[model samples]
Target chain A: MARRNQHSKEELRAMAIEALADLVEREGVDNFSVRQIAGKLGYTPGMLYHLFVNLDDLILHLNAQTLDALNARIDQAAGHGDPMAVLKAMAFEYLRLAREHTALWQLVFSHRMANQAPVPDWYVDRTRHMFEQVEVQLKDWVPAADQRQRQVMARTLWGSVHGICLLHVENKLNVAGDVAPEAMLESLLDHYLSSCAREGEK
Target chain B: MARRNQHSKEELRAMAIEALADLVEREGVDNFSVRQIAGKLGYTPGMLYHLFVNLDDLILHLNAQTLDALNARIDQAAGHGDPMAVLKAMAFEYLRLAREHTALWQLVFSHRMANQAPVPDWYVDRTRHMFEQVEVQLKDWVPAADQRQRQVMARTLWGSVHGICLLHVENKLNVAGDVAPEAMLESLLDHYLSSCAREGEK
Candidate 1:
């Protein structure tokens, strides 16, 4: 009676998000719009409204998935015996994931919300989870550091690697004869770990 | 007499760039267009085309100016007695500029050109000039390091600081009760300098 093929609201929602992800991967977040997504998914704008409260809500959901994929790759790089080695592997994995999903990974950082819009709790939790991965490995390397000190250390180290990947992904860092991203990550870790060693000795 | 109001092509070009800079500063690059610039400057888009080949060319010019402003800030933070001290000052200045001109600074890295379209030579020169400032200060400190080693070292150091500033600019690095950007930069510098000291000792 319902046109011989009826889909539940949840199924439609999943279909929309999947189609949106494909669109974002190909054209980037900046260029894509809700109207385009609706068109791509063969739904009217009014139908999309029935599915998502707003475009921002849709983007938030999309970003959550990107964070999960990053987290899984991060988990693979974990549990290595050496704390330094674990951190290094995590850095490599993070960069590799960024390269693999250039637009999606960039959306994690580049997408801006409206002014005074509180970042949703789910998004914050996802981000904090990623930071926790770094914090846990750092604890082994700097056992004496207090909680506050370790938090600062985790952000500092991850921020550095994030910067390296950002530059590499944006094609801004290859001016000097195409130095591989792996080399850059290794240089950063070598310098950072050597400093930690020196501190331990002191 | 052709016209009472006669401006040379170069003068009109400069005027368009200035108006564009103001437009980007106020409205952001995403919300601006050549038509808007023509509207602001009392000219037609066709007239504007005589000056800049395309919108991309106009953006490249604007980016060059931003890079110069950044290079000037880097220069001010240079020549300080302590290499570590100078590095810290440069980091602070870099963050300050980004905060002062958030959109403009972001455009420096966020603006992506089409594939197969090479970055203009002038833009490359401006970027290389900024890196060279870091290299000169590093050479005085790491006096015995050769050219290739110093190049890698300069990029590594700059990349770390750049990462901190980028995170701070994007509001992604502040999760734990507002750790100062200054504190993060210092932690990175202190650790990096200590590593260099250990390397020198070896």
Candidate 2:
């Protein structure tokens, strides 16, 4: 019975986490308080404390959950077709995810270890594995003459995607004004594909 | 007399802006409120708002200032240096600034946009100019490559840099872990440089 009660409490805590995320997004994460989070859910601050230790604890969970979701999206994208196809799909899907879940995505990417220490290998492994997978697929796309150039190609292509996404996220681009992100990305794709052929020339 | 007062007000706002930037770096942007900003300097939120409409207005000012600073850095790096070298430096500097001014950097990159309309062309110009500069420099790096191929190479390289920076920002790895960001950046540079050479090989 105690175990059952504890499990139920954990589930409620998860729900609270979602609510907390919504609240944070609605109200800027800055100046957010435990009291406000509890108020939003009609609970007392002490009740909230029973589940998570503090704001940092809540944040850590949110960051970890976002990364897990991102990895899942990449994995799902990877499953659709050939490795090369999957690689392209993963890139698009990751960008889409970031666009759609802007708040959650930003939280994971921005509010991280301000004065904290180094990153762990497990986290490094998950991230590295995804990029390596992309590199592998890219190698298959490249001409047989330059398979050795996979890693950098992977990095460079990914950087362009990110640059565009960063622009979108920050509202830094007047996307509706002249050139749209889609058009920009389309050009990027065309350029990258042609560049692969150039690798064979020299 | 009115003009003199207007100029003094502008000067005070500018000073406050710089102070706010420094404070955001020291304290997570999420940690403070307008009241705190006022408290830091023995002023009032009313005084802060007199120069701007509200907290969000102040944020916009700070973000625009940060972007201008970033452009200067990019311009300096992009000038007279080898294109790839400049591209690499521009990227590293972007990440360096992100680390140094976590709050302001987040404002510039994250979707923290509020009460804001679509992004303007000035932002796009910065990005387009950067990309164009990169393409021009790459022409000298390779033996006459097609524009499309160069674009892809540029995109891929940019992605790699973003991925590394995003990784750092998201704290996907342990902030207290073993991998040094500088060493990781160096690895990325080496890999991309070699990859650019590979692009010419075919």
Candidate 3:
């Protein structure tokens, strides 16, 4: 109770998100409760509501943090290189993040808004930005592709990458056989990118 | 209570599973309770327990049914035709099922076992069978690839397709821009399969 006066609203919000991330990483988002977060911070759920509109609001912020982290990783992987190599590296980085931070990554895709409201504009921009990373490389790799074509290409490629990671993380890929996700990803890049390269040559 | 003796154990099990599937298709698997299924079927949770080991068991049964429906649709699409056309049709059928039966298709991928037990042998077989449908077409399209290569190829191609649909179903794909999922799938297959065709030619 005395701790309520110790921090500003923003500070409490950050602390709550940090605690929430740790809990999600440990126990997963399923059956997760706002009280658990407040309990970890020695605060009350009512106090958390003051900082965030509700649990969904807090989760959305956490997901936005995750998107930012993912974007930073993609940026690191997208450093000056051949466009094809950069795209492949970016995807591998995406897969690595999903593998290493299973719960957090799953939360981004799995958590639907409780009220079924549209996602916020900032969040949509963050997500679209991920595709933009691929679009930038595709521009270099296939100069003839216009903005619309690049948008389609980016979604196709990244969506495929995401699908592989999703199935892998959910433990569904092995049902297809014991092929590693890396192998599948490599094969995809080999066939799909080579085809794109040929398309560029034309 | 009077209805208790009306059906044999097997009949009750079947009826309960049918009712559970309807509920899942209507309401999704999240926060789903066995009590709800029993309530729908005019039985008690104790009776559901007799038919199912637990709620996970019931959900697994429902997922298995979903897989069977998907398999049947693919089979219908896979009828005698050019392997490429058949493959494309099968993929489209998959997309159609996901779009039309959104909740049921989602449950097949989204529901995780509460106990974290390895998925049952039959469920694995059904999931693997979905990939095999692709493998059959790949066999015709790329005859030179060995068993292992085809297995990898199937996972890669289908994984990408799954990724596109996943993002589409979860409403994440449009953030990448409004490229139709069908268009993306077509591009993936055109690029990927053409590359495989060239590989076979080589």
Q: Give the winner by DockQ.
A: 3
The TM-score of candidate 1's chain A against the true chain A comes to: 0.92
**Under CAPRI classification, how is model 1 graded?**
medium
**Cα lDDT of model 1 by residue, A1-202, tens digit:** 2333377888888888888889989987577877888888676676878877788778888889999998998888896778889989999989998999998888888777744478888788888887889989878888777778778878888888888888888777767666677877888888886676567556
- Candidate 2 or 3, higher lDDT? 3
Per residue, candidate 3 scores C-alpha lDDT tens digits across A102-160 of 99999999888877777889889998888988999999988987889888888999999
TM-scores for all candidates: the values are 0.91, 0.67, 0.95
> How should the candidates be ordered by TM-score, best one leading?
3, 1, 2
Q: B1-202, model 3: which lDDT tens digit per residue?
A: 5565778888888888888778877886564577888888887788788788888888888889889999999989889898889888988998999999988888888888877787899989998888998999889989999989999989888899898988888888767448899999999999999998898888
Cα displacement (angstroms), candidate 3, residue A157, comes to: 0.6
lDDT of 1 at B196: 67
- Predicted complexes: DockQ each: 0.60, 0.18, 0.80
Which 10-residue window in model 1 chain A sums to the lowest lDDT? Answer: A1-10
What is the alpha-carbon interface RMSD for each candidate?
1.5, 6.6, 1.3
Supply the TM-score for candidate 3: 0.95
- Each candidate's fnat, in order? 0.55, 0.10, 0.98
Q: Per-residue lDDT for B33-121 in model 2, tens only?
A: 78877777567677887788777667767777887777788778877767667777887887888787767776655535454454455
